[model samples]
Target: MRDTNFLIENNAKAIWHPMAHPADMRARPPKVMMRGSGVHVSDIEGRTLLDAVAGLWNVNLGYSCDPIKRAISEQMDALPYYSGFRGTSTGPSIQLAYELAEWFEPEGMVRSFFTSGGSDSVETALRLARQYWKIKGQSDRTKFLALKRGYHGTHFGAASVNGNANFRRNYEPLLPGVFHIPAPWTYRNPFNETDPAKLAELCAAALADEIEFQGGDTIAAFIMEPVLGAGGVIVPHESFMKLVREICDKHGILMISDEVVTGFGRTGAWSGARLWGVKPDMMTIAKAITSGYFPLGATLIGEKMAEVFEADKSGLASIGHGYTYSGHPVGCAAGIAALAETRRLRLNENAAARGSELRQALLALQSRHPIVGDVRGQGLMAALELVEDQTTKKPLDKAKMADVAAATYEADVMIRVSGNNIILSPPLIVSAADVEKIAVALDVGLLSAV
Candidate 1:
């Protein structure tokens, strides 16, 4: 076994963790996860816990996915890396693009632009949106609109478009001309609306108003997550996405779906766009593309946008933006294998079944624990919003939420805590028993918090 103490000591001194205070890591050392298999991960101390967060909501196929591992190994031995830039590309990358084109065909996506990860994918999509507008002779369409509490990753462009203040506050002076409208969160809203359908209409109207206020001719796109994941798994009303799509279409605004979390069956559909029967002009996809086995992402272009770019007589259609590892062969190989496994296992159906069980379990927990202010999610992605008072909906203290997360970890389950929200997103392949196990662990943690 590795020297746990030595590893922890060095890690504390050497590494600066993301989304965390540097001093906090030294004060309370982070868990040293040594290995993972299936939906369980083992720490350096040999304590195994059910990974409810699914490695940051990416590992849809879990850790012990041999097919993905084998594909990566075979690719590494053959041709590990190749630049898919300037007319140079590898066989695996080309094949993977073809596969993704087929996979996302239902969503009207006809072409794919590869990236290194989710942030890159978001950046690619945002840049492409502007480029598309410019190609169509709408050079003034440089502004972007998005929903509040939506996460688009941490890149400069993505962060600028991100709706969450926590992500944008520290990195001020973000890209100018990006506006945000209130999200369709029924639990709490400026309108004090309780009815989900009515709230969705109101939010849609808000989007329309924002577009008009900004001038539709000046706005390039309206970007959003179909179901907000990092923002506490805030699932919008059933019609919210469709309404947004309609508004975007009416305004001549490109709709960019940041499906980094909601893509690849996490939302019980092949893509979150399909979940609401709305086809976006562009979609940003990553995370579960290779089930977190390989870091890869893609910005999928719809037929409408592809046709414009492809038919452009001007040389402006040539995209100058691309990563050095744009289409790494190993990542593509892993993606190919992961996609096959995802289909073979029929994980989307399981996600729907297990997600239903999880939602029911969480709702029951809400009944039993007054601290659980709300339970919201779709498919396997879910969150329990804790509160100090049920009537007032007062949020629980952040420290107390941390304690609850610690208790859950001690109870042998790994969950993600964002503020007072305890997020759970197990692998799509999770069994019924796994759902129960997660519920039981959270029950213990909730009891401790109480």
Candidate 2:
């Protein structure tokens, strides 16, 4: 509603960004997007660009998904809000819950504990894991395990299990007894091992070693993303998750798959767990659950936890955590419609087809661009890690990365530059031409940076 100059002048004055410095943002304001259509967005400057970030990796069906918009509108008119707390429930929430349970059944998820967003979903899952242990009479199993470079969320429990120090340093004194194992990243690892299968084994062994050292019985769960999203899209080997699953099973530890980004056909599969044929004990689903039409998330409970809680005579099985916006009617309606559209379109197959092309193009770019240190991704998610020196692999300067991203935007593609990594996660509806446009934009970015 406000003019561009009016909005830009007061952008950082009233609001602080999620992951940026206030002073720095005031110095250089972020882009203000005014409109979106299909997989493209238009900024206040009247420049339209391909949204390679996919609205923070949530807009899978893109801005033009009419079914979701209609559902939200209809739900707003019918029932704007309703609490899914103790006694009352909404129609949309109940239907969405059943849909989700059926959808994630392959991963063994049987029930849904709704939340407001990804962070809430993760926080709920963590709390649910701890409660499950307590209900099982293992109160001492309060610790958690996560893979290094794996990001959970911003909540205290999620941050404690987050492997990125940048997100953890300022929020110290986090939940205690949280340990991290080395991820199966081939490019950068303590092992310096390049072979995928071998690196997977090494990572699995590290998990086993951690369990032995920490006393597995004391650990409540091992939480990780099937394909790491925020931490440079570090996709582990095909066998890596299965290895972790086996380790968790052996230790009686719950496997909570953080699928906020990889869910809803983003990972070329129904879910990341299904991608590797490993069924986790729990899953945090959000982001694309409503296809960015509304904020909605859920901590999907597996059959194991469901059975324990449902059949429990103990009061410890009772859930003690909830959010005000949990199971919001409009959000649930959006999710139900989004899931329908996602399945009807068979977006998973499209992601597989398009992601293969995108991967090859990025690899080619890496071959041409000396600054490109590495390329890693699965399905629609991918990243280009930049370096100052090809031989030494020194990370590209942040200033240079900013310049590259700016250049890419100028060239009509909007990409996410996190740390030295240029992350690209276009909408699942992205076409072959869109992938080429992204590739071309990145080429321009690399040239500008160099």
The lDDT per prediction is 0.92, 0.93
lDDT of 1: 0.92
Per-residue alpha-carbon lDDT of candidate 1 for residues 30-86, written as tens digits (9 for 90 to 100) = 898999989999998899999999999999999999999999999999998878676
Point out the worst 10-residue segment of candidate 2 by lDDT. Answer: 312-321
lDDT of 2 at 364: 100
**Regions of model 2 farther than 4 Å from truth:** none
The residue-level lDDT of candidate 1 at 194 comes to: 83
- Score candidate 2 by TM-score against the native: 0.99
